[model samples]
Target chain A: MQENFIKATAFAALLSASAAVGLTGAAQADSIKIGINVPQTGFAAADGTSALIGAQLAAEQANANGGVNGKNVELVVYDDQASPKSAVPIATKLVEQDEVKIAISGSYSGATRAAAGVFQEAGVPYISAFAVHPEITRSGDYVFRTSFVGEVQGRAGAKLIGESLGKKKVTLITLKNDFGQSLANGFKEAAEQFGIEIISEYEYSIKDRQFGPIVAKVKSDAPDAIYASGYFFTAGPLVSQLRSGGIDVPVIGQEGYDSQKFIEIAGGASEGVIITTSLDRDSDSPEAKDFIAAFEEKAGYKADMVAASGHTAMKVAIAALREAGSEDPKAIRDAIAGLTLEASTGTISFNGLGEVRKDVQVQVVKDGNWHRHSIISDPDLLAPPEK
Target chain B: MLAFELLLQGLVQGSIYALIAVGLTLVYGLLRILHVAHAGLFTLGGYIGVIVTNATGSLLLALLVAMPAMGLLGIGIYRTCYQPLLSRPPYVALIASIGLFIMMEELFRLIFGPYGLSFTAPPLQDTVAVFGVNLKEAELATMIGAVVLIGGLALLTLRTRIGTASRATVTDPKMAEAFGVNIGRIRDINFFVGSALAAAAGVMVALLNNLVEPTMGSVPSYKALAIIVLGGLGDLRGTLIAALALGVIEAYGTIYLGNLLDRDAIAFAFLIAVLMLRPQGLFGRA
Candidate 1:
């Protein structure tokens, strides 16, 4: 009865505050701020925007449902522009001034690492939404990511292209950045395991607006599949030019091209492109079905890997908050490390390195939509599934 | 077969670089200003071309719309920013133009964000088999367009009255005024011509690469700067020849260096060595 009186008094105060205001009221004043960063204006902006929109939609929906223990959640948005040069300053500003106790972000691996330094120095826990580099998870104590690293995705990716597709010969064309290099290395390592031969390995710069020479080389090699580990900027033109060059084969890629820009660039011609990504919305799990329905309803668009990663990161963070029974950074960090949340995408429990347990999904870009299929380990794809 | 394909691939990529580099050379040659904003102007042209292409699904319309739009912008920049500072110190104009570059870059970013806009390649997907070599649709068409444009510009400079006037004024501004030439008019027209050439290259790049970003021109700009210097500053024929050579070098370099070397560094090292040996440039008069 004494606890009930205290709760009743708090409710009465919140109601009185709502009554006295026209625009500013209980909702605005009682909001818990969460810092959000992404490349809102650079090469990776499309993916960043999609992830941000999905996360924003989730935040809004959660707020509608009385938010994080009945306190409204406010997202403090900042544009990192996908630069380490810019991300450091933004992270500093968010931490020092806005005082957001928790943050969820990252697009480029480099930018994430740069911000991770600041967050670690300040002892703030950050849940990275989509940085795939292994170095990011290794930076410091406060850094954790819901997305799988490029190494895991890379090895899994190569296996999917080589073994699942029954491809014997392949061509490797990728950007020479860390993100691209890591995937190439993973694929190379996995190739020996699967007994696949790489016919040609062509490297291109992110600034190189031409892929003709590389595609031409790939064509002459006559590989069964062309594996490109780059974003839409390079892959879109490379595949189109390859087809135009009269060399048509299946082109497999990593998770970088998972954006509407890919479809927009590839157009109807992107039929045979296969890419490896995780957290597919069309996954058969009941939680995945609920997430897909809810995400589509809230975002008015389909969920992809980045969105799935964001959902997982948020759930992990919030679950940690609940387990700790306090919103402090130390409590949240311990809580997150010990969290075993059943996210819509999959069950996630981080190891010491702060990566989700190893499991990946392979998706094919066919008829202009991401079609998810059975996991790579399923031996059925090699033969035929009984319809 | 692979070697032949790689070289041909290099030439095609080099052709686009040459086209844009020559445009930068033109603006630099006529205006004696670095015009750091040249790349931004090219990006704007690309944006205009993209919108036109998407709406009409016509390549020619996109090029036509983008060309004039970029020309008008060039004229505006000249009259507003570069013209008023004509009497001030060269350093003042340099600073002002730099500021203009920042403003233009931010404006494009505000409207178009940082993501590259996807542009569908036009109806030139038909392949031409030459001596059993399969040439790409858009690449061959672009090379043809670049050559024709370069030839036309060269003819205009040598044969036209305004072209002669521009040359005469740059050589001796006071003498050209005394000879009854409208120097300002010639400068304005040169800006239009130069900017149009850049915008044309911009549209072609979008078609070739199938993507356009506001900052795309920076790479071509540095390359053009190197080409201009290597070919002989203020030497159009030299710029053209040097651009082709740079393209071949880049292809070989990428093949060898594995795209790990800085493009500017490679172009600079070769150009600088050439400059140290011949101070006036390959085509520049001593």
Candidate 2:
């Protein structure tokens, strides 16, 4: 019994020694660490990869200008795999293990939503690069979003679908998730304002690639337009299926559909698909031109809306850090809440809800490329409706 | 007219389901290995098919090359992962298969990137009118290919020597071995044929959908699992029939009910309902 007790004590001592070494190893104060939680695999991996590129560019630019009060910014990235279950642990690792003052989520809404509570509980400032779910920012004051809320994008989409395109009767196909449901709700609420009648609303699983029955229903109903609320993967096949099934109504989507991959997947069926996004690729602004040139050169491809949002979010985080002139999370959060800067997407300023009120670009697919259609600058349209 | 169109749509979907599930059933019936990695093979087949199609500009060539390649891969998988685990518990082999599935998905993601890839063949993009209903060319190809392959498999099992040996081994392995049948060789051949069927399903699905991604195998694979179970695990004819029924039900349900349950959920719901009434599945022997 005495030998067993001694063994237990020795084991306990070893564990303590190891843990101390680990904690000391992680708490090094060499550079400012900004935790990056992005989906490197799974459904949203493409967007995550693009967002990573944009974040890296932001870090490079900041470092070139001498990062945040003479201390270089170090981006510590982790793959949340676009899953909420994965995001929780990743958030804990970023805050407690990596000792980061702030975290940037470049993943989809699900992951960002999952990590927000953790960051808030830990009192670490959290910023979502492109996730647009309104509830993300509403999680707590510590959480902020560089992208506009889904409700804002959906309202703009409804206006474009109803008043601008003059399609009064519509069929809605939603993705059956938080992002899709919220967007659909926003569109449904505002759809009546412009005399647009929603003939039918069909929800589908994200895993669904077959749209035969859905297409048949759309054909029989024969609405003036079809608004699909999903990401580019679903939108691509949904458009292809609809067109191939010979139901060629105007198809409209939100920012999730704004990617070159969508056009490629749709294979000419993407023509005339109107989408509301945050970035205008053809903007003539000198700042836009310069940002685009620099981004393309660094990224080795054209920057999409998500990539621009990521770059903008990183810039905002850095700006907050600089303005605070300290590494305190509370100070950084305060600086971010009051930040106002011109971004590649537009002028970024946070509302009371910590959601960015920025320009939303409207684009259309024509001749297999995204062409600028119009810009919705109305603040009333951009603001999230009172809860 | 709408009902008729829905029936045809069901048949198209059912054909693809059967194409995928049949191989899974075959492997499970003879080996009792579960073969969860079958879905990964299907996705690999899609990648190979697309690569070949782009390189040769012939969908036919893609189909031919992808099947053989996947068949060879199946043999390699059996040799490397399964053969050593044969002496261990069956669940050990299942765990290995799950590991393989994850690795294959990661490899495909690394090779193809995370975006959805277009698998369009220009000649197959045109839609054809079938009984006054518009159907994509790939759908027609899928139906025809499924029929030929399933029919051929049925015939081979009914009228071939290897088929008889395979049945013998599955029924009583020790007895079959006593009668001079090499059970190991039979298992290898079955794995090859099963994996080839999964690959074929992958190619057809990619063609019909006009897009393929690394994670494409996961959903269909889960559906395939439900299919194998609901069709009375390891029952060949039962799996085929259940697959068709599932397709028709999913079609009509999605149309009339309007996404009250997701199409995949509808399938599981059907499986549960059927299992409640008949626990041995539709065709499991007493």
Q: Could you say which candidate leads in TM-score?
A: 2
Candidate 1 docking classification? acceptable
lDDT of 1 by residue, B1-286 (tens): 7566667666776666666666666666766766667677777888877878988999899889888888888888888777766666657666666656655654566587656676654556667875577886776777788788888888898999988987887788889999999988988887787788778878877777667776677676567777888888667788887877777676666666655665456788778888899988877889
Each prediction's interface RMSD?
13.3, 7.6
Off by over 4 Å in 2: A1-30, A385-387, B120-123
In angstroms, the error of model 2 at A304 is 1.4
Off by over 4 Å in 1: A1-27, A286-302, A377-387, B1-4, B89-91, B259-265
> Model 2, range A34-128, lDDT digits (tens) per residue?
98898887777899989988887888889889888888888888888889999999899999988898989999888999999999999999999
TM-score of each: 0.89, 0.94
Q: Proportion of native contacts in model 2?
A: 0.62
In angstroms, the error of model 2 at B185 is 1.7
Task: For candidate 1, write residues A1-387 as lDDT tens digits.
Answer: 234334545765774455335212323676676777887665567677667776776676677776786677777777777789988987898799878778887468878888888888888888888787777767776888887667666777677777788887988887778888888877887787877898888787777667665666666678988888887766777777777777778888867777656766767557768787766646778767777677777766677667677776766666676577767899889888888877766766777766666356677776778777546543221211111
**Best model number under lDDT:** 2
Angstrom error of the Cα, residue A197, model 2: value is: 0.4
